[model samples]
Target chain A: MNSTKGEKIFYGINYFVLLLIGLTCVLPLVHVLAMSFSDKHAIASGAVSLWPVNFDSSGYSALFDETPIFKAFRNSLIITVVGTALNVLFTVLAAYPLSKRYFIGRRFYSLAVVFTMLFTAGLIPNYLLLKSLGLLNSYGALWLPGLVSVWNLMILRSFFEGLPEELEEAARIDGSSEWRLLSQIILPLSGPVIAAISLFYGVTHWNAFMNVLIYINDTNRQNLTVLVQQLIQNQSFMQEMANTQPEMAAKLTPEGVKAAGVIVMTLPMLVLYPFLQKYFVKGAMIGAVKG
Target chain B: MSKALPPPASAITNPSQEQARTRSNWLVRKYGKRVLKQNVPLYLMFLPIMIFFLVFKYYPMTGLVIAFKKYSFLKGIWGSPSAGLHSFQMIFNNDQMIKIIWNTFKLSGLSILIGFPLPIILALLLNEVRKMIFKRFIQTFVYLPHFLNWVIVGGIVVTVFSQNETGVINHVVKWLTGSTFPFLYNETSWTSIFIASGVWKEAGWSAIIYLAALTTIDQSLYEAASIDGANKWQQTIRITIPAIMPTVIIMLILKIGHLMELGFDQVFVLQNDAVSNVAEVISTFMYKIGIQQANFSLATAMGLFESIVGLVLVLTANSIARRFGQGLW
Candidate 1:
């Protein structure tokens, strides 16, 4: 385990390069975070540097008070919780039977999932379908296509296969049926995989704006991501229309507010990251590496 | 209604235990009962997902007919007349059709080719680092940009590459040479900025998978190669790269499946009228043309075409992977 002079030099160079690359990723976030805290006047005057200069809580206060930003927060929570529930439920149900190597019609069922993954009907068909089902502006629309994420199903399926058959066999011998065995025995051992899928679904649902934009046009049903988008939309449109708060409107920098919204929107997930990441990446790699 | 109209349930409905026995028999006869009866909890677990997909995914899948029809807001889906492929032609005649298709190919292909492999290379380098803390630091830092919102990333890109004299890229250009490079405006440079920014944001996070694959690359092989006097370069080229090749190939095959996707959120936020010609990718185009303009039929046709192409590419890629003995399945 000894390094020669050349090996040591090479190692030193490699570390420096990685350090530089790492800095590049971290620094921009610092810039945005700093900007989010800086006062509107200072931000507009270009006084804000990499760190905030002339710091103020006005932007944060205004964001929380004047806007439906909090309402959006509540909406995002609903969609994420409900959507993640659906995602995990459907993915596990579909994946469980399909994961069984001996399950009848397994290939056909799996092929159906694969078919959905490969070929989508696209926006128009999906939109019309939602309209026909009268799902427009409903919470269900937010979680529809998202339910049964094909990737999650695949990951959970892989996790299920990794479980030893003997565990299920023991339950079967006690007169428990396959359904009970999966629930009481199999699913109990699936904590990590479940956590990982739940996090994945949660993030996707939390970050979802496009589907909401397409399906639910009503402002009342808009989620946080869509609401942030509305802030962006308002900033651009405010000058054209009369500013709601004419006094503050002149000094309002959409740049900082938009930056604040990004932080607000992604911060919850960021906090959730360390807690779930150990499982999320492992679940992902289990499928990515092994498959 | 039956209970209201008929005599109370106390009459004859379920008064007899024999009636209950017959009802149980009927239920058993109607549906083959007790097949994995214990797994009802598992079925219960899947209930929400099944309902959601049934409503959202499968229903939308069946709703694909809107692509083939002149979707009338009044007449509704069933009453609408099918276009007999004319909607596809309307999409083709949009004048910007070729540009949209070209941008999609360029963006997706670039992201797939260079963006795809850089992660593997970075992973290989990091895997060889040997220092645990350093490896973790590299991972934590690089993975961050991937989690960042595209809006923030787009702002950062604009700030650095602003077309103005004080812009960072402009400043660098004026100082080093003599003129400004229109990073956003110039069509030729737009694709590179988009793809490079994409790579910067994702390369580290993406590399995590390759790194995972590398971890499984039997450590004994490396020990054997080192004992034979293989240098770091030789060992990486001969053993490590080959070990991770299957994962790399399988990832490549999957990337092929998403050839038409073009990262809608990223493109939608980053693009502007200045760079519209080059930056107007299919996904963004669909949003504008379909959603914004409300030309439902044309947009649907375009969306349908993209999906078909994507589907065909994925099928072909999966088959090829199957042939080569590698795929996610």
Candidate 2:
């Protein structure tokens, strides 16, 4: 428990390096936040850095105005909520049965699931299958293919396996049905793992961009990430829009608008994160140890 | 409990032993049927998940045959004529194929080289911290970037490294050296930026495992080492590093297994016309030719190639790890 002066210096250097690394991770996002609220002239002149030179809310208001960004945000919310729901439901259902020692064909089913983690039919064939299934251009394309993540399933299964067997046996002896056992006994005791897996699924669903880009041809149905990509690619046009639209010219700058878009898209996860941060860490550790 | 118990031993030796044997045989058959029947509810619950995996996960695997076929919209996957190796031949014959493959490997290799050890180092340094509040704060801050999707991270990368006057890093470089570097445009700077951003995003998240492993190392070993007049550096090199070596090796193998996939999301978001040559990895290339250009067969062939290589690498890595006593399986 005691350290010499040399060890004290080593610990000092360690804290210093870690603090620097941590700042590198956070400072850019902080800069983005400052830019999102900076005045148009301040943004244009590159005066904003870690803080707003001249404070304004125009960029955020511009986002709220009749923009495709808002619609995309709504679509993203819908998909994340529904997709995460299905993900947890399917993973739990499949994991619970497979966790049982006496479940018939458990080995076969477990292998079938684990095989997916090792190989996948690449994007082309997956796209083709979805096209044939009439899921293309639909939200189903976004949600259906990823309904059950094999990694999350394995984590949940490991958690389920760690549960005491005597509870289930006792429930069965009391004439409780399988549904009752799962709903009343197993699930009640599984709050932390469930929360952890749900956070993983929620984050995956929220960040979906490739599926939206590839399968959904309809811009109306596209999510915030796709919209953000379009905004980034069309930076010139966005700047031009600021010049042409008098109201926007008064209120917004292109850089500030882009920063606002980034903030809006990122804010949900950041907001939800602190409350469930421990669960996220727990989920990652579970995946590392078990997966 | 007594009611559920079997009869006493004297009853089993009587003339009813014959009847008891037949009855027990019947009971065995009945028990087997009941066990099978008892599984019905569980099977029903699992039915929907099984159907989902079959349709989405397993069925698309069968569609990999489209790589070997002259796939057409009207003919469908099954009805399409077998092109055999024609599509693969086209892929191999193309000059861009080599460039794409090389790009995938070079980028991924560089990332793994630089990015792989960072988390271990971070975890080691973080382990030295005595203040819980400070450690937790640093952990939270560093882990924040991993939660942001590549789209946002890519945007931050572009913003920070923008060639314009406003770019934060460019401004600093100009201030220091009197000239700005085109970090995202030039091939060299682009690669560096790409790898750096990857490290920034994932290193902390990856460190969680190492930190967890560190906690499992017995505390008494360090105390013993200190008692023997060993310093912190000596203890780390002698005890801490060796303790986490298996985890480090397993993680390295897993990283190597995905060498073909230079993260499509990260590459696609960061890619532009200027850096296309160095940035166009296999996944992005496949997306362009297969999804954007609608060259289904060729794209499928390219995808199959990537998948096969990935499979081989994973199996090879797993075997190697097993030989080293650190295999994932």
Binned by DockQ into CAPRI classes (incorrect, acceptable, medium, high), candidate 1 is: acceptable
In model 2, the runs with Cα more than 4 Å from the true position are: A236-244, B1-31
**lDDT of model 1 at position B118:** 83
lDDT of 2 by residue, B1-329 (tens): 55788788767776777878878678557557667767888899999999999999999999899999998888888999999999988878888888888899999999999999999999998998999999999999989999999999988887778787677778788889988888889999899999999999999999999998898999999889988989888999999999999889888888998888778999999999999999999899889989999888989888889989988999999999899888988
User: Interface RMSD (C-alpha) of each candidate?
Assistant: 3.1, 1.2
Instruction: Give the top-scoring candidate (TM-score).
Output: 2
Q: Which ten residues in a row are the worst by lDDT in model 1 chain A?
A: A233-242
Clashes of each: 5, 0
Task: Provide fnat values for all models in the order shown.
Answer: 0.50, 0.70
Q: In model 2, what is the error at residue B67, expressed in angstroms?
A: 1.1
Residue-level lDDT of model 2, residues A225-276, one tens digit each, is 9988777667664666566777765677667777888999999888887888
Residue B217 alpha-carbon offset, candidate 1, angstroms: 1.2
Model 1 per-residue lDDT at B35: 43
